[model samples]
Target: MPDTSFPGAWSVDAEGSAPPFEQLRARVLDLVTSGDLPAGFRLPPVRTLAEQLGLAANTVARAYKELEADGIVETHGRGGTLVSAQGDAARRAAQQAAAEYAAKTRSLGITEADALELARTALSLR
Candidate 1:
């Protein structure tokens, strides 16, 4: 029995703008990035978490799929899903941040070339 008691009080706001899966995904990502849910922490099975959160099993599954796709967690058949190593999580986080930045730039009408240049400048400053 993996500890289903997630570190903090995580809940999906049904009335919030974001869908339940996105909310769950973002919360888990935050926990991983903040080290609250350290590497090797096993997440509850999708059905289990969905029941606990009163969400559809598919919703939980989708969230887990996205997390796995982002390399923040690894799903091993019966072994269950566990948080990835810290270095991997950090790299994934940076990639996710870059994706979000690109989306924001696009929304702001910034060209792809400008966005890449801005990112380059930002990296050069470090």
Candidate 2:
């Protein structure tokens, strides 16, 4: 079995502005990006982590699904989920988002220079 104990305590703030599943997803993503959960680190099974964190299995499952969709984690049949290589995963996710943004801007008839400027402004805000 994969280790149930992650590097730090994990909790879902039921009263927080974000939903529980999103909070969990963000926490796991933060861990991956921060190098606390290294590449190839297997995460606990959904039910097991759900029990530990007092969340519904579905909630944990949704978080894992979103993480996998974002390329931050890979799910193996019966082998469990493992963190992806941070640098590569982050780059791929960013590229995909940029592509989607570009498509949307084009569909909206935004000029290339305007789109580029909007992107630059968003990056600057970050």
Instruction: Write down the TM-score of every candidate.
Output: 0.71, 0.70
Quote the lDDT for 104 in model 1: 100
Query: Cα miss at 77, model 1 (Å)?
Result: 0.4
Clashing pairs in 2: none
Cα TM-score of candidate 1:
0.71
Local distance difference test, each candidate: 0.86, 0.85
Candidate 1, residue 80: lDDT: 91
Candidate 2 error regions (>4 Å): 91-126
lDDT of 1 at 96: 89
Predicted model with the maximum lDDT: 1
